[model samples]
Target: MSARDVLEHLQRLGMSGYEAKAYVALVGAGRPVNGYEVAKRSGVPRSTVYETLGKLVARGAAYELRGSSDATEYLPLPPEALLDRMRREFDGSVAVLRSALPAVAAAPEGHLIHGLKDAEAMLDRAEDVIAGARRGLVMSVWPEEMRRLREAVVDAAERDVEVSVVSFGEDADPFGGGRPGAVYQHKYSAPEAVLEDLGYRLLVVVGDRREAVVGGFGEGAAWGIYTADPAVALMAAEYVRQDIALQILADRVGAGEIDRLFATDPGLLRLLGRARS
Candidate 1:
């Protein structure tokens, strides 16, 4: 990284800008440097350089030395050592907070609904749900999302969690040709047709009958709702179950007949949000 980047990062780690600059200047000097030299090299103001150096010394980020001439010089703690100390301190703080935070407030009682505002957030929550499944998971996902979530689903399956997927898109092998779980390819409509009909790509995931994520993915935009509401979870799971059952029915009968029904049946057309011809 650039020198400016290093200084910025140091500042983020609780150093003042002048302190970071002085520390970097000391490190770059390769020897103990006085306040004047630190200010000259680091562009820190001469007035504040000694104060910044004093702070760094107080923080154990630098050492102060008294030369034979009785002038004070500052030497930086090695970058590796400074980083290691910061890491240890940070981890310790986190560990304390992890145990202490629960005492601060009781968790809210009601099932909460969270909004995921982007595709990455949706995928992350989906992956978390899949990974946390203990009994079963049901999901309707497109090819791209399936690829992204395949590992988590497969891992859950490996843990003996029952996994069922209703996949969309043209790919013949949704799980990259691996049978991680019971996968049903949605043949009732093409992915493009479904997207056009819904005006967005739909994704639903339910885990262990306890939590559900329902979302829409679109070009440069994605949004979703995640809930631990049992009713919502059951609905999302049932949606996938119905899709899987329909796919099985299509396999037993034929895709052509299902298409004919969808095209002609008023109920089916209405479900698809299409007006009767």
Candidate 2:
């Protein structure tokens, strides 16, 4: 591998800049090298090299030994050994992360949210809701929300959870490939009929217990509401059903070849046909 590639690989495996550089220098030197020479060759600071070397030694990727002047010298562990040690560290971290994450409760579970920060927080809660969902999902989304929403959907899909999305064409596949569900991609009847303006309309309705809605208008940047009430969830579910209906009907014709038979509406079905082409 190239020098840059090896250095990057080390850094990614949790090595500090000096530590990675020192390790690289020792790897090339072909034998133990004193701290000063190691720092000079690696371009690392003399003052910090000892500490960095100690960390590496503790990790078993480096060794300290007697040198020609009775000074301290360091050696890099073999490449495979370094890789194995780092992999074990990564596995343990992943296991800890998996254990810590699944235990977190969605704070407030359901609550109104306003402003950018609250909206962001609400998005996090949406992740927990989707992670725990079993039967189905309904979501209303726009482009700005894509980063978080896409992850939630992909995670759900990866976990085999059902996901369905309703969104304007910010080009987010709320049902992205990871999940085996549906994405409703037809345009709404009117510009007024979106997640906002009609008042806190953006929402995620999961199963029958939780529904989160956040919107004051995508551009107007207003507040939104979230609820655990079955009544509210039911309302959100119905709204999604209606939007999904449009997607279902439109996708069939616009997304498929039904366009030749039904050309009046160029909805999802027509789009699907065009996509196929």
Off by over 4 Å in 2: 1-34, 37-45, 65-72, 75-87, 90-135, 147-152, 174-181, 190-242, 246-277
Per-residue alpha-carbon lDDT of candidate 2 for residues 8-75, written as tens digits (9 for 90 to 100): 98898898888899888889999988888888899888899788788889878889898677888888
Worst ten in a row by lDDT for model 1: 169-178
TM-score of 1: 0.62
Best candidate, lDDT: 1
The per-model lDDT (C-alpha) reads 0.87, 0.68
Worst 10 residues of 2 by lDDT: 188-197
User: Which pairs of residues collide in model 1?
Assistant: none
Q: How high is the lDDT of residue 268 in model 2? A: 50
